[model samples]
Structures are given as structure tokens and as C-alpha cells.
Target: MRRVAMMRATFPDALVTGHEPLIPAMTNDPKDRHVLAAAVRADAAVIVTTNLKDFPSAALAPYDIDAVSPDDFLLNQLELNRIATLTCVVDMAHARNRPPVRPVELLDRFSVIAPQFAEEAKAQILNQSEPSPWLIHQRREID
Candidate 1:
């Protein structure tokens, strides 16, 4: 709830409510129904979640939505925009100022949560030479 509150605070207009009207028993798990309801309400293109089994492609295909694991999602982002993704990861590492996390340490942490994404990201970061348009835009926005 605290993290939700922080996200709400950060992106006030991005958060959607009134999902109750869209509620349906889309999944076997009652607890996961809310996730489907929210996606329906928002008309999301994709639902990024670790629990891919709960959101089978057959179930989401009807709604023109696909459920993707966080690993796959991050890997897609890394492949599409390697420079921006690498910059984001490096920025995240620097943000852990309490212990001053190194980029390798951050990648190591990601290995536990999303091993495929961590491996791909590390490879992309090491091989990438040119800055992506996304990274250039992000830097401009920050500056």
C-alpha cells in the first residue's frame, strides 16, 4: 500500500480507479481477478506479471492482451532500447546511496529476480556503442 501510495503520488494521472465495474471471474484464483479487472478497465496492451500461469495467453487473447513475465518484459525493453535500459539500471544502482551499490551488484541482484533479463542487459550494455534516441530524450528531460 505504501508503494502504491508513492506511485500514485509520483504519477497522479496515470493511476486508474473504478475497476469494480469491470470485475469478472477471469482467472481461477479469486485474488487475481482484480488484476484482470484493472487491465480490462485500463484496456491495457500487455499485463506484466511474474504469475504468467494465472494469466494464460488463451484467456488474455480474447481481450487482445498478453501476459508477460517481468523477465521477458525487461528483456524486450533492453533489446529495443539498450542504452536507455542500461542507463536506467545504472541510475538505479547509484540511487542505492546507503551502501553505494555498484552496477555489477545491481545486475547480480536482478539475476536472482530475473536472470534472463540480467544476462541480456549485461551483454547489451557491454556491446552497445551508440546512444539510443530514448536515452537521449531521457537525458534531455532530466537536464
Candidate 2:
């Protein structure tokens, strides 16, 4: 619960509560109803998840929500805003502390989950004319 508390503290307005009454109404996996309830209460348009079976289309269609895979969602986000999406990835890499992870390294790790999106993201970062964000960051540290 410490991790949840930390998340709530970090993003106060992102929290949604009092959705338990809706849990019994959700048709997805019984174990995942709380998530569905929260999505319903939050009026989410989509629920990106690896466990597709847990959030069936029939179950979500009534609420006007779609269950999408994380890979597809990331790809969609990239397509919607290429530079901003890639920059967010670069920012995540930049925030790494104890064992710093560079953007290339982070993309490599992302491959295990979202292979196609990671490949395209890596290409965009490398193909861009500007020095890669990681290179610029490393150069700053060295100086």
C-alpha cells in the first residue's frame, strides 16, 4: 500500500474513490472489477491492459469504453504526437536515479513489452537531426 500512497501523493487529482458499489455490476473478471469500477467512475474511454480477457468488449461497450493492449495504446500515442511521445520517453530515462537508464537502454527494455512501438520510437530518436537526448544529457554530465 506504500506504493499506492506514494502514487496518490504524487498525483493527488488522479485518485478516484467510492467506486466499490459499481464493482458488482462489472462483467469482467471478478478480481478485476475494482479496476473496471474505477474506470467507470472516472469515465475512461479506454482501458489499456495486457489481460484482454479481463476486460471484454461486450462488457465495456455499454460504457463507451474500449479495452486496448498497451502496445496498441503506445503506438496510438506515438502516432497522435510523435515528438511529445518520444520526449516523454526521454524524460523517463532522464529521471532514472540510482542506476541511470539511457533512452536507448530504456527503449531496449520497452521492446520486451511493446516491440513494434519501441522499434519505431528508437528509430525516430536516432533518425532525428538533433543529437539524441541521451547524448546531450551525457555530454552535460561529462562537462
True-structure lDDT of candidate 2: 0.83
Flag clash pairs in model 2: none
List candidate 1 stretches off by more than 4 Å.
25-28, 127-143
lDDT of candidate 2 over 67-104, digit per residue (tens): 88878999999999876887788788888876998877
At residue 141, candidate 2 shows an lDDT of: 34
Give the lowest summed-lDDT range of ten residues in model 1.
134-143
Identify the candidate with maximal lDDT: 2
TM agreement with the true structure for every prediction? 0.79, 0.85
> What TM value does model 1 have?
0.79
Candidate RMSDs in order: 4.7, 3.3
Question: Model 1: which residue pairs collide?
Answer: none
